[model samples]
Target: MSTVPRYIREYVDVNVDFDKDGRMLPKTLIWEDGHRYEIDRIKAIQPAPALKAGGQGDRYTIVIKGHERYLFFEHNADYGDEKIGKWFVERKVAP
Candidate 1:
């Protein structure tokens, strides 16, 4: 079996859209590497607002390291709260 690379990441809720079922649709999360991941894992949904309020809450923290940065979207809704609104993406610095 092969191993998977992980990285310590943080996600913040960006936006939410309600469907006919009144259930929340896919939420956008800003990853640590300054990328956005859209996922529909209800359980992974976190209250974005609370996190900004400085209140204690649960967030999906993982370790990822590889060339597949796009794969981060697979673990969407893995952190932050729904109220988080939008998360800031870090800017790249020149070496």
Candidate 2:
């Protein structure tokens, strides 16, 4: 049998803050199901590939409730997405 994708793209709502010079920082992420998670800290931000999902943008290595997770932001307006872009996370699928 073919193995299904272990992860699926899940769009989430994020609350962001910007520094005086326009540096973006994510503060919280609301799940698709309306659950909100506060980002405890941001460890790193850099351009990286999005594995298991095609959307690629700046990757944020953040800690939420002491649990580490990767969040992605896809800001390609060429795809006709929102001008402000969107955020997404990979949700693991049970076997």
Candidate 3:
């Protein structure tokens, strides 16, 4: 039997760039350890579904160091009564 790699969701700091259309594009990933990884290439982008109540989000699939990684950003309305944004990176573990 073969094993599938599992991705662990972790919040990370990211620098994003927006085009003339105001679309968010990831540029670099800043690790808490102070190591920075340039995005290099973007494989896919998926917009998060909007909730009937409010808050919306976006997800980007990126390639870094020849590995597939996911960068996610979301806005939550009720966390602090004020809208707040969250950023995260989903990293995969080899099996």
Q: Count the backbone clashes (under 3 Å) in each candidate.
A: 16, 0, 0
lDDT of every model, 2 decimals = 0.39, 0.88, 0.73
Candidate 1 lDDT over 1-95, as tens digits, reads 76543333243445556899874444555555567655435444343323322323333232233212111222235366553333332223333
Candidate 2 residues lying further than 4 Å off, grouped into runs, are 1-5, 79-82
Candidate 2 Cα deviation (angstroms), residue 75: 0.8
Candidate RMSDs in order: 11.0, 2.8, 6.0
Please give the range of 10 consecutive residues that has the lowest summed lDDT in model 1: 66-75
Off by over 4 Å in 1: 1-13, 44-95
| TM-scores, each model vs. reference | 0.28, 0.84, 0.65
Q: Positional deviation of 40 in candidate 2, in angstroms?
A: 0.5
Model 3 clash number? 0
Q: Which candidate is the best by lDDT?
A: 2
Cα lDDT of model 3 by residue, 24-77, tens digit: 788999987978999989998887632322334677778998988667778675
lDDT score at residue 81, model 1, on the 0-100 scale: 56
Across residues 1-95, which tens digit of lDDT does each residue of candidate 2 receive? 98785887788899999999897899999997888999999999999868876668899999999999999997866766557677899888875
Candidate 1 to truth, TM: 0.28
